[model samples]
Target: MSLEFELCLRRPFTLLAHEALLNIYYSASCLKKKAGEFLRPFGLTDVQFNLMMLLKYQSEQDEGLSQARLSSMMLVNRANITSLIDRMEKADLAIRTPAPADRRSNIVKLTGRGKELLAQIEPLYTKEVKRIMAALKLNEQKTVIEMLERIRGNVSEINENTTQDVSLVRA
Candidate 1:
């Protein structure tokens, strides 16, 4: 369906670019909400599930990941990560301990319960993801991957130019 029709807008989009941007944003928002709903029955939020997966896959050692490291990897703020860890800790899904190499910083690791939960959820999650993407053929999916990468590159360029322009104005 067209973006205007989906949005119930009386008027057309001002430009094709505007319509495309809105489509992407709307699609992303809907996907996030759907992901949240899918995980809700398992007593996990999308962010929490993402953190657990990162812990399971990204940790190179048994000691787990530093809060700083997880924040960077997740592209979220440290404070938000802290709160998420705190909630996970309360649920016994994860643990925070002083990093062996740096006592001042905390490392986040999945608890045994977390690992078990992830083990149970992963297969179902993968199946659901496949079902969701089944609307697109394999070739179409590949084309989408390429287009999204290009969009990301363009967005990065815009961000860099915006930062430079702001600094110049400040100076």
Candidate 2:
């Protein structure tokens, strides 16, 4: 087994694997930077944009989303979402209203100003998304998305295992 492992290392497989990991990390960082640049004019970070979009979509159902639900949906802690909402509220982009049934919790809703800003930003956002998609052929784009989804699924599985381990340890 040791001799076989040594022979495998002599092949290009190890180098290719390292290069792939590096490429994935660099590509993700570059894309994030580009997205941040595109959103700079709107004074919105990626999380803020996600939150705003969430609220906008929720509004269509004639329902508001609670902060706890938003935090869970965003995969962030409640305190982080609370702070983000506070800043957005100060910017007049959103409002936090007490939930009718849950007085202790608040629902986040987009304000009129937020709706106007979203409208103004929609074109630029759409253009950026189009530009990203244009970089790849249809098949390549689909493959890329599928590959990313697989990676995400694997990571989630690992997280679940880790969580279970921690719970077992505590018990």
Candidate 3:
């Protein structure tokens, strides 16, 4: 069924671009909710699962990623990392240790339990991802990626300009 029909819209979108944006947002929300339901049985949220997987692969270096680096890599606020890490640590999925080079900074490490859980979840996750991706042909996937990148680039540029204007107003 069309998103317009599903949403029960009385009027048609005036512009294709408007409809596309709304469709992308609506689909992403639904996908996230479904994924959350899938993850809940393992006692982990989607974000926690993602972080564990990242650490499992990225832990080539001793002690894995520093809190600052993890925050930057995950595009999350540094202030939130402490609480997230704390929960993971409590669950015995991860640990934070003092950085070898930087005394003030703490590095994150995945625990054995985290690795085991990730290994269990990865197959199901990969299958789900592939199932969703199979909806589009390979060429269509590439085109979608390109279009999304262009949208992000244009929006980022406009956001940066708006920030500059706000700074100028403040100054």
User: Each candidate's lDDT (Cα)?
Assistant: 0.94, 0.84, 0.89
Off by over 4 Å in 2: 1-15, 163-171
TM-scores for the candidates: 0.94, 0.81, 0.93
Clashes of 2: 0
lDDT, candidate 3, 27-98, per-residue tens: 899999988998999999988987897797776754588889888878899878888999999999998999
Off by over 4 Å in 3: none
Tens-place lDDT digits, model 1, residues 103-149: 99998999999999999999999999999999899999999999999
Best by lDDT: 1
Query: For candidate 3, what is the TM-score?
Result: 0.93
User: Residue 13 lDDT in model 1?
Assistant: 82
The CA lDDT at 47 in model 1 is 94
Q: Which is better, 1 or 2, measured by TM-score?
A: 1
Clashing pairs in 3: none
**Candidate 3 — what's its lDDT?**
0.89
- Candidate 2 local lDDT, 1-171, one digit each (tens): 332263455655456656566567867787889889888888998778888888888555637689999999899998899999999999999999999997999988888898899889888898888898897899999999899899789889999999999999999
Q: Order the candidates by TM-score, highest first.
A: 1, 3, 2
